[model samples]
Target: MSFTIAIIGRPNVGKSTLFNRLVGQKLALVDDMPGVTRDRREGEAKLHDLSFTIIDTAGLDEGPKGSLTARMQEQTETAIALADALFFVIDARIGLTPADRAFADFARRADKPVLLLANKSEGKHGELGAMESYALGLGDPIQISAEHGEGMGELYDAVSKLVPPTEDEDEEHEETDEERAARPIRVAIVGRPNAGKSTLINHLLGEERLLTSPEAGTTRDSIAVEIEYKGRGFRIFDTAGLRRRSRIEEKLEKLSVADALRAVRFAEVVVLMMDAQNRFEEQDLRIADLIEREGRALVIAVNKWDLMEAQPGQIAGLRRDADHWLPQVAGAPIVAVSGLMGEGIDRLMQAIVQSYAVWNRRVPTAALNRWFEGAIANNPPPAVSGRRLKLNYITQTKARPPSFVLFCSRADAIPQSYLRYLVNSMRETFELPGTPVRITLREKANPFAHKRKRPN
Candidate 1:
């Protein structure tokens, strides 16, 4: 169960600043100009041991309230109603005002737990304004410098107190494998413009929510759509078709590229869609390399397969080309599908689920050590500077793409080639093809051996 917290205040009170602070990222655009944020941006937030959702709302203002402002206010109010707690922020440098009082009354009427924050309280000049926050009748104000990151401990305490602990059943329920598998698999469809990305999504969803045409670059934003396939939930992200950076002249195209990169970062698996006629372009390789660099699971879908006029052994020729050109993602599952005709959709989904499972796999410590020993036995680590390097043990330190740390006698002397050998061996042994594996070599610490002996 996740809780949401809304940051509400007038313009330039550091509401966006505080939202970024709580979320631990600059996800929301922050500028000195008033009314910079027009939309309600949300992010995952963590405070101490608690993790929740944080919403950055547009600055509340007074007017006959135009449609945009009214919509912003409605979004803020919706967040307030849904949130377990709210952070009512005010600029301490400017002190309290009638507008602040008006909003305080609005929060009071809502009957929700409100944490009054006196933001911009970094200097002595803001002391009086911080003291003035008490007049809002929202209880004692927590002095904070959202920009400077002061008083976060108190904020964490306040939020944790407001949101109750998770029930034991809920905690246990999350531990089940079914629960783990039930999480929506984040999948990103990436390719060049007019490469049938939007068409593919529209076909999968059996709707026309996405605008599709022969024109290139029709979709500028990365749009996420949720669908259940065979009773499994999948969150598919349709990203803008990324063109070569040198060719991107328009400002919107630049933004679109950034958005596509962001989508790649957020996705667990990337489905690289390509036109069968124009497959394996330089830009396509660049996109595939980006996915590989991000250590994401990958599945290549050759779209427009129905339109391809092929002779005998054409499909075999294409497979050989893929094997030779994309050796980094060797053995990646490639499905020749016509998104227009909905061919191979089921096989594509199965490949996606399988790739996602491989991406999230965890190798036990004992099994990992055994594999490491076997690998070393098969191909020993090379001797360096007349010294044979001894690799003691290997253990996985992290999992979302499976990272391991190898404790060795001399980590600095280990060459990159040896590391690659170990990684390749692990990939083959664990059947983790087409997925990037990270192996870090570290010198083992020997505390007892380093201590000096005491002579009586």
Candidate 2:
């Protein structure tokens, strides 16, 4: 296992900014607002020749037990326990405060090697603040600017002293393209409140890692956990249940919803959980529509199957209803699952794998154009304002929810119904089901207009 480092600090201390710099990507959500990150996020980070895993944690703050902030602090403590080393960051511009001192004591109790980071250390005031941090008695503070990429060499030197690279790793090369491609697939579990989203995640992990209850909104922040299923790695993000916009009056709930939306945008596949008893409710349909609009691979998991009284055609009926209401994602895979009892999980996993494959599928251009020719011949594009529409060719522009562009004459003349027809035909013909398909029409210029026909 790689040496693990946890970056913990009070809110808005540039901890996330430093994490982004180390990982070389903006994987975490960064905002001017404090506590933007409510859950612990892990990433592989490299500094100079040193490679290790780094964890970005929620800002440490004291809160009443059972409150949302309290739960966020629990997440931070969990990261501290898991880390071999800790990066204690403070806002140099603002200088140290009671909270910084309080968290410093907290880190001191952890007994792990801790590195004091005086972030935003780019000015004279910052230097003065770094000098003040020495009074905390942690160690000499490393002055570094996370945003401007200054003082990284000192940061690297400090981290290296704590966790040195192994000799075996020194002889080994960097991760090849194929190894990188095999990284875990990101999946987000999302749905309405009390829809068994967290329960389902617990079942997959085979542990009560996520807090669950019968209450309507047990989950708040989007918590991501890594898992391995059938020799495949997946980083599953369990998101807070979404509710009607008008009903969300609490500021905290709104932030949680925003975080959940971010998880959906970042995920490769999303499992929309639904209560078996109250399946296909208005909120459920709305969430499904949002997922489709985001162009994500989707799997419908009707949870709590054990509670449902057995009916002869219950599964078939559920499938029919899903298809009828959610026509945008027509033919999406629906699996009946009991999160508490762990029934039908294998099939749900299979459906997710299949959906992900379809979302990433690419078709050959020649095959696509051939299918287009046949479909157009059977049901041609309608004439618009006395001019016949001509579709010259169709080609897939990209995949990961299969987008295509059709070069034709008078692109704006093509009706939405025609585009729908093409999308549906393409879906069926290309074996792509339960995935969003985008088709764009482009008008081809008429080159022959400059050479007028000679008067005969």
Candidate 3:
């Protein structure tokens, strides 16, 4: 069986940062603020030759029921229950607090193998804090700086010891010729300039691997990074910031935008990043609509939230704005994050995984046809050539923005407005928000039902 490790800690302790380090991508958001992560994010991780599943959990906190803090804690608890081992992270620069102690106790009660980590241990200043980690009673501490990538060897050793040898498992998992031909998840990250797209990537890689600048249009080409998640490999494409056509004065900028659009077409999941200050700009909506039109799974992320003054109403307000402006993508999970500060990174990742799950969701043909029948019963297809269009059968042809092919009569005569209605109805009925749904109408020829014509 594949080993599973959970990264647990208090807020701002670099749990998500360490997660990205292990997963080899800036898949998680990092920020200085506490309680930024409010969900459990899972990814495939590898250290040296060791491979395992990694769960990045929200920082633990005590609060009233249904509150964000409480919900985060609950999510962490869920991670604790699911993990085979736990990596309890603490900030070496800040030392431990009562909250950390409380969470340590919680982890102890879970009875799973636990590794204490003193993260951010880059210099002598962090040494004292690393030494102090012994008090947690979780055994010797592994000191490392997730941001600078210091002391990764010790982390690899510690994790290797906790996980059983996978030599035989590896042999069993070696892919045959047919297995190697399987398609991989195609992901593209598109956003406006300086929306933390590169920062987010750097965070995932746990290194300053991407060139980041304050200037707009810094990235000129699409970069592809392949990594594993949940024991499966995924290909993530980071594309250049898309600017409006009117602003494309430079040839290089025009090329970059075209390249970004091409990336969108190739992606199965198109993650659209938005600057928190300009959450739902016309350009943002346009990008989302374009993704939908291309039949790609969509996930919206709000970046650079550290600079914003967030209130209790901020998330609600953003949700309302998304619904009002991008109704086609309604119910799309909008994760608030500060890519620079790393806040809300875990939640963002969880949302990605969830959206991916939905994108790959396939409804049974029987159930789908039943729903189709009900939809047709509720609102019949528009009349064409003085005859009502007959939609006979529907079958899901593909997923990753679930696509269906409908066998019907007079497919060529079907109106675009009616197709839009069907698409909207499917979206609402299937709870597929923020992602595209494709339906192809094909005319069916009757064989047995038709009378034999005079020999033609």
Candidate 4:
């Protein structure tokens, strides 16, 4: 296992910025608001020739027991326990506060190697704050501006002294391109606030790995957890619930929403969880539509099934409603899952595997062209402005959502309704249910257009 370090401090001390800097990617959400990050996030980080694991944690605070704030702190504590070292950060621009002093003691009690980071140390005031941080007795503060990429050399030196890389670790086999391609299937779970997304993921992992509470908007970052089911590996991302655009008033929420969207785009399959009681609302439909528009394989989970009164044909009814409300994603898998009780867990995982297969399915050219011929024979292109549109050959361009290209006499004359017809027909013909299918129409170039015709 790689050496792990946890960054912990009072809220808004540039911890996330430092994490992003180390990971070389903007994987975590960062904002001016304190406590924007509620859950702990892990990433593989590299500095110079050194490689290790880094964890970004929620801000340390004194929250009332059993409160959401307390749970956030609990998440931080969990990260601390998991880490081999600590990066105790403070905002150098504003100098140290009582909160920082208090958390300093908390770090000491962990009895692990702690590196004091005075972030935002890019000015005279910052230097003064770094000097003040020495009073905490952690050691000489490393003056670094995580945002500006300053003092990284000093940081590398400090971290090297604490945990030097071993030759065996350096000889460890690096994951190759083929290995990456065959890695775990990426899946993201998303829905409205308090839809039991976290609960479902926890149930899957058989542990309370993610911080969850009854309160809405407890999650503010897209947290990815890797797990296996029936010998297949999957990297599941639990995202912050997406609300209506107008309802997103705070900057932090907006950042969270953006992060969730990035996760959706990054994922190979997305599971949209909804409250079993209030499922299929307008917003739910909107989210489903958004996923289809993004061209990702989707699975709808009606969560909290235990709360609903089980009725005869309820499962069938759920299917009918899913198809009716969101025909764009027609034939998509719908599973009634109680994330709390682990009901329908096997079915959900099966659905995800099936959906991923469908998403990456590619059709043979011969079979595709044969279907095209039959489709045009059944209902040829309609005449527009007294001229019959000549439909030419069709070919499948790619698959991961099964897109195709159609050569026609007049591409501009093709109606969207006609395109929808072709999309539906191809979907039915190819057994591609619940996956987005794209078809592009191109006008065939006339062979004799350039030849000057003799006046007859």
Q: Which stretches of model 2 miss by more than 4 angstroms?
A: 9-38, 45-51, 58-77, 89-109, 117-137, 141-156, 163-181, 213-221, 244-258, 364-370, 453-456
Error of 4 at 258 (Å): 0.9
Q: Candidate 3's residue-wise lDDT over 293-318, tens digit each?
A: 88777888899888888578888888
lDDT of 2 by residue, 1-456 (tens): 789999999999998899989999766667777877776778899898789999998899989998767877887888899999999999998898999999999999999999999999998999989999998899999999999999999998998887776545446678896885688888999999988988888899987667676778777668789999999889999988899999999776886798899999999999999988888999999999999999999899999899989979988998899989998998899999999999999999999889998999999978987898899999999999999999999888898889988899988889999998988898889888889998888888889989989999
For model 1 the local lDDT of residue 120 reads: 92
lDDT (Cα) of model 1? 0.83
Clashing pairs in 2: none
Top lDDT model: 4
Measured against the true structure, the TM-scores of the candidates, in listed sequence, are: 0.62, 0.78, 0.56, 0.94
Per-residue CA lDDT of candidate 4, range 1-456, in tens?
789999999999999999999999998898887888888999999888778899999999887998888988998999999999999999998998999999999999999999999999998999999999998999999999999899999999999986677454546788996796579999999999999999999999998888898889989899999898888899999999899998999888898899999999999899999999999998899999989989999999999999988689999999999989988888899999999999999999999999998898888899988888888899888899999998888888898888888998979998888888888887788778888988888888999999999999
Comparing 1 with 2 on TM-score, the higher-scoring candidate is 2
For candidate 2, give the lDDT. Answer: 0.89
Write the number of the candidate with greater TM-score, choosing between 3 and 4: 4
